[model samples]
Target: MKLLRLVLPGLTMIAVTYGLARFSFGLLLPDIKESLGMSEAVSGIISSLFYFAYCVMIVLSTVITTREGPRRMILLAGASAFLGLLVMAVTPNVWVLAVGVFLAGASTGLASPPYGAAISLWMSRAEQGKGNTWINSGTSFGIALSGAGAILLSPYWRVTYGIYAVLALLALLWNFRVIPRAEKRWKVTFEKGNLSLKGIKGANSLITASLILGISTAAFWTFSRSFIEIAGDYRSWELSGFWVVIGIFGVLGGFSGSLIEKYGLAFAYKLGSLSIASASILISIAPEKWLVSFASAGLFGGAYIFLTGVLLVWGIRVFIKNASLGIGIPFLLLAVGQVIGSSLAGLFIGAWGYAPAFILYGFIGIAAVFIGPKKNKAED
Candidate 1:
């Protein structure tokens, strides 16, 4: 019962942050663009800004988690999500919308690190990996729920976002009740010129792996549905179904921890990198094929979530003493990579068209399989 209580709140909190706050933007953008007379160029810039906010918050979150601890930071993450959604629900202009997007994006950054701490602090050693991955899978739940709501609540972006705010508010309340409070704040000082990679082993490899994976995944997340819709001529609801399948299979990604427990991080990471790259290749080659489309969605969704789970465990393993930064730095690098890759993908699509651009990204994913040293071992 104690473990269940912690998992539910963590799951819902992640759903709100990753699913509602982050990915739903892509889903809602068509309506938002139509309503606001936005251009692709401008929207891309806004998207980059969203990632920029995510990157900044993730960097700051590590510091805050170090000084204040994870419980307090988690609450702040939920609050940021609520405020962001509320702003989006009522925003009358693009600038305001951008503000909302940034805050919402930051929530994902803020959400990640603390949970690492939470699990390390609360869950037993045997249970921790599963709990962390299970919580991570919450993003799938949020995405699926949003897709369903989008189908049912057609053409009401504001209402959709408003509901997201209310759900976030409830999630905030639930998390507040379940997540314990921080003890008195502590202060730590870092020298100006020198950096501290103290207590974190294999930081370089982790950053490298995360950055490569992030770049590879960016093209698909930002533009795959667009290609399927435009090139494949999918009916609107079919696209919704596409997203639904992704989320559903992503939930299945909770098994990543099981895979890691049985096989280990190197095996899991290699499998995920190959699977994710294959997903891109699968979709890019046959965007119009219904069978392939759904299969690609499933593969990408499961593999994407699985790979992030691998990272989470890997981070915790290496940065054993600093669990929050363990999670934060790798994820932050991934986000930073996304910021660069997503931006580059936008330009690449303009010049090269979707198939070639996607194929290039897929190749990069394949390369990611060999990023680090021969071993790719996680510290015990």
Candidate 2:
């Protein structure tokens, strides 16, 4: 029961950080671009800036959380998010929105590492996969809600931002009330570790996997709405439906803790890599609307989250001494890939069209299979 209590709060934190702070961009992108009078390429660049800040802050966040404890970090994260939303709601210019998103991304970055670490500390090694999945599931749920809600509340972006700000504020209060503070000496222990070069090989492999994953994932995420708009000849409703479908499958992906547990991380990673490649190809070639959209969403959503879960667990297991750094390294690389993909998406779409870009992303996914870590006796 106590464990369940802990899990709920952690999950809530993930939902707020990921769903509201991060994933909401997908839902609100069209509105934001229209309202700000920005081109698609510029909009993508703005969104990429958020990820850029997020990537830089990951390591710093890990250090702070390790030293100060997750409770304090959560509070700080919530505060930053609230401030960012406030800026977005009221700011008069695109540059200001970029600054707001950067702050918001950094704030959310602080929550993830400590939250993952804290959850790991609370759960036994045998149950880590399930525990992490439950927390991540919150993100899926939040994405579903935010996407659907934003569409339903369209033409009211400012109001939506206000509501999201309120959510973050509430999360801050909850964190203060529910999470316990750490001892003063936790900082000392957190700082005592000596950096080593031993994890470089594993980190490199993880970074490669992350980059491929990001390219594949970003292509879908950044372009899904546009794709639907063009292919389905539909509006916000279809895009919302797609997100809802993805979230449903995303929940299933989260519950796939057993798959990771039984088959091991390598198997899960390979499955995700293959699924992403296959899905991208199918989405690229399919002429039928329902088949293309639903299949694309379900397959990509499931595979992406599954791979994320697998890689995160694998990082913690393989680099136990510096698990936070291990996780942060891959995430940073992933963010870079997202920025690159987003920046180029408009160019590719305008020049060659969606099918070609989708095909290219599919190849990237296929490459991930080869870049992934091979089975080794030592790895085992």
RMSD of each: 3.4, 2.9
Per-residue lDDT for 201-305 in model 2, tens only?
A: 476677778887787777787876677677766656776877877766776667656786676667777888898787777777762486677888888777766
- Give me the candidate number with maximum lDDT: 1
Clashing pairs in 1: none
Could you give candidate 1's per-residue lDDT for residues 73-122 as a string of tens digits? Answer: 89989999999999999999999999999999999988998888777776
* Residue 109, candidate 1: alpha-carbon lDDT: 87
Candidate 1 ranges with C-alpha deviation above 4 Å: 184-195, 372-380
Write down the TM-score of every candidate.
0.93, 0.89
* Alpha-carbon deviation at 361 in model 1, angstroms: 1.3
Show model 2 residue runs off by greater than 4 Å.
Answer: 39-42, 184-201, 376-380
- For each candidate, how many residue pairs have backbone atoms clashing (under 3 Å)? 0, 0
lDDT of each: 0.84, 0.71
